[model samples]
Target: MAFFIRWLKAASFLETKTLILDASSYIGGHLFARLGTERAVATYYRNPVGNVVYFDALSMSLSEVVKKTQDITHAVILIGDTKPDSCASDIRKSHALNVESIISIIKFLKERHIKPVFTSTESVFDGIKGSYVETDEVNPILLYGRQKLEIERYLQDYTVDFTILRLSKVYGVSPGDGTIFTSWLEQIQRNETILCSYDQVYSPIYVEDVVDGIIKAIDTGAGGIFHLSGNKPYKRIEMLEMLLSIASEFILQPVNVVRCSINDFGLLEKRPLNVSMVNDKIVKAMGLVPSDARELCSGMIKKFYTNGAMEYR
Candidate 1:
């Protein structure tokens, strides 16, 4: 009986050691907090946060970081260029980090038998269709999406024991989190005219839900592609209206709303119209039911106002 208990402890310890690459990223920060510093070690290029070591995908070696951290079972790769416009403008620079460096890291981890959890984007699918599933054909419109798909394809063809989480637009509750929701709130608070796309559609999942899904994926040893998204698809105009309605309850101010096409933003590439992914795969794998987007927005506003912590910029 004592021998069995000892063996279980050893197994648990071996399985739980995870290394979070790009721990300074928004998702990485939330994940680090959830997993705690002891259970997970982190790597950052510029900002060295809690329990993180320096690792530049361009200049440094991934093996050195791996050598420093022993008995690591999983390495969540979050280091890459995620900006659509930036990727479109400078393909070579972005590809070097997004594709080349990432592939190299995957190879290193694979050689050592460490499972990799890669955070992909819903942008992999073209916007012509909504409610994308794992089996659907992907036609990424944005350069960022294509870059992500490149890695996804590499993983599918070359590696096993990898978790590809194709996430939707992830938003946080904080005011300056830089997500569309909070950024709009900041603009509205400052009485700036908000131009929202009437045709754009997506599943905007909460950061908490994304973090939960990633942690669940790692813990359960679930491999394959999964979509971590909101409960339902929402139009850009509808989402803005929902936020406006919720914000009106907390702040008494006249807000300006301008309806426009996504092209009006002057982005280097055209945005997808309906990149809303279905989270059924993750649901079946981890039983992760995402929080309602409207409810989450309402709760976030309520928390900020009720706590009296919101400062108008």
Candidate 2:
């Protein structure tokens, strides 16, 4: 009975009280759902979904929010204007949230004895080269990437116990998930032309894989930076072609696939062409083997058909 009691105590210690900021966001929502309300606390900005508390970084500080909520051993920050065009258009506002507010939260958490898990993007790389490792030179071309890079630099200099997960493009398996694959599938179903850039290359990871990696990082008490991305690098057009090939088996309508340069997509800022990362650090640290984009696409396509596509049609 005493040995069993000791084992229960150890298990309870492993289950830390995690605070998921911006829990309404895509990644945040998935983490909250996986962790559940019993093991995690969620915060929302506008839409309060699945038992979340209000937390507007523009108005309130992390200290204020922490005071109102339960004690948290770790905080997963998912706040900021993630859109590149938006950040480029309004530099001041986006900078305030992405850099300043994020730093403030990290400082507050560190001061209050809370481990912070920040979700950064793979855009920190300049994309001149593919398959970037953790210790590679970071030169961000887009404004959004610069902002994320700034935080990463700060974490390297300031904190020792921080977990910075630099993620690639994340996609989900559900319908209307607003991921690239799902969006393309919808357009294909409608018989619309899909214009994908041939120059742009990136690693696309499954959302569940990302969630599992984050949990593993937290549970295992991982520190420093880790790249959470897909196993292989693929050009934008290559990924689209893969999707089209798989989609041919299910869809009746024939959709046009157009290949264009990355520059053809007129944006306020220029994007990196190849931001694929080498996820060896994450694999070594967390023992994570991520799913490839093709596998995820096949699963999503099968799920879409099995759930009755005629209703969607």
Candidate 3:
């Protein structure tokens, strides 16, 4: 009874740490839903939290974000999924078109208000010759890459207490979302053959690990651009094969998996042959280790199969 009482007290203490999430996108929504189990929180621009204020980025101006920040202990800005479409074309024009929405929040916060933390991506790197570090020069080749790079530059010039997380390929089991794993899962479930890319290689990070790393960054009040990715790199088809093997365990149906070249898809933009990131900085700074891709895909498959596709939305 004494131990139980002490444990309850410690849990209660953890519930009071307020962190405000801006933009209720993929990672933002996932973080808020997960954090609700253990932390106190608020939101601006979006209601990642059920009971918190929903600051609509479209309707609410930046001053509102500043006002809300004053009341929270920490602020996290998730920059993806803001636009309706995730395609490269929409992403490239997002910053210029959403300038009013972006400036409002910046102006609001600049008035001696709460500090903001921004999330960016490694897509900013062109993936030309080698892996990139935090201090490396950014030369993005794609539209999505360019937009993220612009946002990073804007945020760095706008605020002092900001941290930029340059993420790599993030994979998880979110309902209806077309992650690399899910795309293959969909085809496999339908008893269809999946032609995966053998040439493309990337460092895939599990979404949960990204969240944990972000939480650690928040705790330490660490600022600056940090790489959040898996420890090792895997070819695109190798990852698909791993996912197919895991799915075969619970799923009785056999999936036809085939290797194909990137040219087959005729992707709009030229993708980097190797965009594997080295997350030594974040690991060293936060003493964190990301989970392997195999484990992540297995868990994702299990969740999808158990919950069914309708639960994704």
Candidate 4:
């Protein structure tokens, strides 16, 4: 009995040792600014046994993952996906920096007996579909979605010990700029007209909520697939309206918003109309509740105000 107990303790210790690699750390890059140092440390990662290392996925190859690193219980790969209306250069970056590199990283992690936690996107589905689940069919419309779906398929193979998080449209205050929310804030601050789609709909998960879900998945040792998203879906215009309401409390600016349809854009890729995913599986397993986007965005605005003012990148 004593020997069995000791073995269990050793197993538990091994599980706690993790190497969290934020390949695409921009989503929460400057979260430290808003969350402060100590709180950010506790929120971003908590390891009782092992050390944590943050490196850009593009900077290192799979060979470096094994050669450069020592012991780790698991490795989390949060990389990939190009921005909306990504150009040729952006697509190339997604392939070279994320898609290709992650394949090798997964193989390396598997060989070393380390769990691989990957972040996927809701873009895997064509926007016509809403309330997608883990078992739903994947039909990517954009290049970004297709690449992410390709990774998802690779990880689904029998040999990989992995956790795939299919995330919704992640919305939060980017410490830098260029995010949809930040861009809207920019136009609002300048009192300029903002044009957005009325037909488009998506689950807008706050960046902090995304971080929270990632931690929960790691702690629960979640394998296979899960959806991390907000409690509901909102049209692009609706979200912008909510943001306007929130901004009213902090800023005194009347901004003009012009609502258009998805057809307004004449781009190479046809954007998905509605690709919001349901969070039944993630919520049930992780014991997490879907957050209200409005409340979360309000919190983001408050955080920005507390830090003097929102700075453009």
**Distance from true position, residue 170, model 2, in Å?**
0.6
The deviation in Å at residue 90 for candidate 1 is 0.9
TM-score of 2: 0.92
Best candidate, TM-score: 1
Ranking by TM-score: 1, 2, 4, 3
Residue pairs clashing, model 3 = 62-104, 62-105, 175-312
lDDT of 4 by residue, 1-313 (tens): 3223323534764323344454225553433233333222211222222122344455665554344334454555665545656623477776875578778778777666667778888889997778888898989888888887778888887344678888887765755456667778767767788888999888888777777787677667777899988889888899888888887887765677788887787766778889888898988999887678777667767776666555421
- Assess candidate 3 and give its lDDT: 0.67
TM-score of 4: 0.79
Greater-TM-score candidate between 2 and 3: 2
After superposing candidate 3 on the true structure, give the runs of residues whose Cα lies further than 4 Å from its correct spot: 1-23, 37-49, 65-70, 80-93, 97-100, 174-177, 248-254, 299-313
Clashing pairs in 2: none
lDDT values, one for every candidate: 0.85, 0.85, 0.67, 0.68
Q: Look at candidate 2 and tell me the lDDT of residue 14.
A: 57
RMSD of each: 3.7, 4.3, 6.8, 5.8
**lDDT value for model 1:** 0.85
Question: How many collisions per candidate?
Answer: 0, 0, 3, 0
| CA lDDT, candidate 2, residue 130 | 84
